[model samples]
Target: MAEFMTETEQSSPVVPHPGTTGERRGRAGGSDAGPYDGQEAAALLERTRTLVDPELRAALESLPGSLRRIALYHFGWQHADGTPARDNAGKAIRPALVLAAAAALGGPTAQAAAVRAAVAIELVHNFTLLHDDVMDRDTSRRHRPTVWSVFGDADAILAGDALQALALRLLAEDPHPASAPAAARLADCVVELCAGQHADTDMERRAPDEVTLDEVLAMSEAKTGALLGCACALGALYAGAGDEDVAALDGFGRQAGLAFQLIDDVIGIWGDPRHTGKPAGADLASRKKSLPVVAALSSGAPAAAELAALYAEPYVSGDAEGVVRTALAVERAGGRDWAQTEAADRMARAVQELSRAVPAPEAADGLLALAEFVTRRTG
Candidate 1:
């Protein structure tokens, strides 16, 4: 299991290159170091995306012109004004997970059959993102104006709906044996995602003190973990993995997803905007009930009381100092420390869950590396 040293470790950061085990260990600081082998991850990502990009483009082309334009801009396939561009699309993590899971279960040769599942998962992810930007009223994503901010909310909403339909259509139309269950699983995951988003929205409407750690964690799992789990499970199904193996893969993804969410919250507070492509202290400025914020408020410490006082009032969006203060308050209340520890523990647990499905170390290596990759970034 690859879990890196915490940012607080007070050591120089070293990004390990692809090389011998000794070289990897040296850069990672120990023989047992769990670091992301970037070359391996990059190659897998590029190859998988190369395989799926054309089909994904064709899927977008099938949409009506208005929607297609919106989708293309959103995907970074075109400039906001529809001029051609090569801006990077979103990180194709979910789809890569689909192929990695399939390779783990059925070997690399069998992964081609699972491409539809990968594409379906990516479409569903973007659907949630479009609706989420509208719901959150977020003006920016990946260094550009969010879809709803550029276009109207209704257009963004309709585009999200269309994308959701496209996901199901891909699954339903695929002739593979796993298509039916994959579609069902994707639909079920969407329901959970909506439920999580609802919980999140509901919490924002209430007093910050009224939100509990358990509630926030559950919401994180639903909103993020469900889709990731479904992505892995669909891959397993395509690989002809049995129910138990499929369930284990889902568990692996779910735990890793939770860890990813935790780190994302941390990044929201302390991340450099230049690196993260979001406003500095964005979550604190929005006063959204991110995991660490809720955890600090619920910690029952004096600092928790101080943090609650800040949250009892709304966060003004442009008040950089106030957001910084709120972040410090959360840290003082042990929320940041707790989240960091929990995220590390969860990443390790994810590897254990992965082992239950693919017992072979060779088969499990890529999945393990990807799981670590989730926690390796400041962004």
Candidate 2:
């Protein structure tokens, strides 16, 4: 079977595919490969939303009219017209990570206590999404018009800013000792995310050849990995874990986040529009210097020149053939293979870090399944 399977297929993300880089590296080592139920990850995510929604909804409700409307719309809880809509918040991956990490280390008690922290982390994630959509000028999210597209850019930006404030406030009002540190860590992550976003915009202006693999990797870590790491670490903190174990959990989340980004980039170029809710070749149309694109440019293969030429010229609207050729160039230049292999390797490392904290495979199943699901989904 192909690694890039259909988005609708039932995939066993818990186990690395045979002969893949993760399998060769023994993803979680010998004892870490127990009976992992992929369905548990989904259940955990659903449960996380159940536990965190009320608090999250209350926080959003606290916002004044304009900001509240935008925030609520952005979160999928309300329609553009401010009427109630079916709950459509995203997958709740980050919050699930927080809760799962807590459960892995300290069992159900810790998981219950960490609900507020999970909500805070979710708020931060959505805050970034709102801002990112505006900065990227993306027109859609969750199959609906983006905040910036529906409401003006200024409103979207203000809503994003409000979300960040709300996240910190949730932590501040909590009496839990972990709340203080979690707040500080989340604040730091916001700074790093902003810096990473700046670097991303800056990279887009530069020549493709000028951006290095290391630079893009660093930016990915800052923008995506940092928050994930903080999520896991906050969970550990709430569990009363020592610093070392907390750091290990953070490392696990960071590595898994990088793997998730790798797959996400691949999907950006080739994912099905039916599932991704975006036009095909959207990344190519935007001339995004995604990890694969950068890797391909760095390769010395003849296709590198072809890809460079394709990237050098701005993509004209409706240039389907051009997008196909550019995607082919990236593949022939070894970008696709490299990114997949790299993602598996990152997963292997993530499992290693996870094992350091939660040695038992059964205990770590939730985190592992969530990590795999994020990395395995083609859309």
Candidate 3:
């Protein structure tokens, strides 16, 4: 059994993923076998896209025409010229977790029962991204121009709002017995996401000293963890799971989401831009208070103090050397090591949480594979 850990303990030397200036990065140990081995993960993702994309596309059609076009285009369903495009879109991880959880608890036959839950979660996930792209002023996502960058901010925001409403309406209109509680859970997730985003933006505007590690963790759990938890919980609900099972699945996804966020913060700093679909050091360049940055600031090392000095002023957008040095300073301050350790620990706990809901290892292979995909990344 994994112990519940609330503090970070650390060690490591890491490199960026391959094709980023020809430097190859790997995890600390040899590869482990599972359904989620990268190749299989891609296949699982494709299978999920085939399963969920039709229903997801159908939801877009229920929107107002102009808003629907913008949303569809944002989803990589259409090109800027309003023609069909075959590009892959969002990662589809959330919806996959929902179906995987349902399958784990109630077997493959429960997949159809979980469709409404899957669609609702996926819609809410995209809605968050649409709004996030606008707020973050991100120019690109999935290597395509962001919705706000392409369609203008107001229209993008309107489309996002429409999607959120449509997600709830899907549940409310569905005849499934679990729809009402699932809808309530999704609504709660949206509220928490908003609160988390508010906390994040609020932190950015204040001094680095003003934020606490606990505060950042709380904000992260709300921002990234809440929806993931809802996605998993909705599946159990659809499977007609007991309260204990639902709660366990929720905990599994929540802890894994937190672990995923920790790795994401590391990627935001050191990950290859080619694989991540964003500029390297984008977070540092923006001076955003991401978890690693916050953790570094909270550390008491002299390097931490220096990093705090760097954050004392606004980051110049084009200062590559500054970004590189900031990343180095963060690592020296033990920020990177702490995040990696925390992520691994959380992932183990997440698996433990899964065992509570589905005791048989074979039953949880799919969900375990998904959880491993979160932490055991090469890029």
Best by lDDT: 2
In candidate 2, stretches whose alpha carbon ends up further than 4 angstroms from where it belongs are: 1-37, 274-279
- List candidate 1 segments past 4 Å from native: 1-33, 316-321
By lDDT, the candidates rank as 2, 1, 3
- Which candidate's TM-score is highest? 2
Across residues 171-286, which tens digit of lDDT does each residue of candidate 2 receive? 99999988998888889889988898888888878988899999999999888888888899999999989999999999999998888788778777876676654466888888
Q: Write the per-residue lDDT of candidate 1 for residues 1-379, one digit (tens) a residue.
A: 0112222221111222222211221112223334554557667778878978998989999999999999998888888788877956666778888999999999866588999889999899999989999998878676668899988999899999999999999999999988998898899999999998898788889888777899989988998888778888988999999999999999988988888788778777776665555466888877778888888888888899888888778777577788888889999998887777667666666777787898887887777666666555543
Give per-model CA RMSD. 5.2, 4.5, 6.9
Clashing pairs in 2: none
Off by over 4 Å in 3: 1-35, 274-277, 316-318
- For 117-173, candidate 3 gives per-residue lDDT tens digits of 898898888888899888878786776898899889998899999999989999999
Residue range with the least summed lDDT across 10 consecutive positions in model 2: 1-10
* Cα shift from native, residue 6, model 1 (Å): 20
lDDT of 2: 0.82
Candidate 3: deviation at residue 281, Å? 3.0
Per-model TM-score versus the true fold? 0.88, 0.91, 0.88
> All candidates' lDDT scores?
0.78, 0.82, 0.78
- Considering lDDT, which of the candidate structures 1 and 2 is the better prediction for this target? 2
